[model samples]
Target: MGRWVLHLPVALPRRVDAVVLVVALRDSLGHVPALDFGEATVSAEDDQSRRTRVWCDARLGGGQRCELPLAHDGGCR
Candidate 1:
């Protein structure tokens, strides 16, 4: 197995109730029928700098994770 770290910076207009990181297999039909791996309630932090940090971890090729700042509208602004 290979080790890797993925970081994704997501900026949203509003904060969501929950953020999930998912890993799945996509077929030729472009359909993700199921999630090969899933993680929830990652890491969300507010630096008081108008930004929230959300992040998670998985195996190689699993997916990307990030930390985001909190916004006023429930979503990342």
Candidate 2:
């Protein structure tokens, strides 16, 4: 298995609430596998240094229009 990185933008209203990362993978057959943000150092900065890292299991899909859902853990299961 390989690893994939996903960066998401923090919403304004949700900034007050903690947000976890969600990584979704889709292929020609549609959504197959995905992962949630377990370990991260999320920050609310616009600079490159302030970025959250979301790890996902590769070999899922690298095709076009791959749906990626980003949300808090237990929020999207």
Candidate 3:
């Protein structure tokens, strides 16, 4: 189990209905794991910076499931 704090910078259109943040995790076998984090909503007013906290569980059968120095993919929708 590990905790990660990410600071994200978001830019929104002048006129938009809604914005969302998406995060995805993959394991060593290129398999998507059961992630504890979900999509987060971003308001138009939140144009500057956003702070996100994530918890990851890399344990699998008493060993590490994912590769070392894990990389995360995050995007705004």
Clashing pairs in 3: none
- Predicted candidate 2 versus true structure: per-residue lDDT over 10-71, tens digit per residue: 55434334332222222232333453333333456555486554422223445422123334
Query: What is the RMSD of candidate 1?
Result: 12.1
Q: Judging by lDDT against the true structure, name the best candidate.
A: 2
Clashes of 1: 15
- In order of listing, the candidates' clash counts read 15, 0, 0
Top candidate when judged by TM-score against the true structure: 2
> CA lDDT of each candidate?
0.32, 0.39, 0.37
Model 3 per-residue lDDT tens digits across residues 19-76: 2223332223234344423323344455435533232234555544432222345422
Candidate 1: where is the Cα deviation over 4 Å?
Answer: 17-37, 40-77
Cα deviation of 54 in candidate 3 (Å)? Answer: 16
Ten residues in sequence with the least summed lDDT for candidate 3: 17-26
Give a tens-digit lDDT track for model 1, residues 1-77.
97564444444333453343222111232254342222223233453335333322222344542223222233321
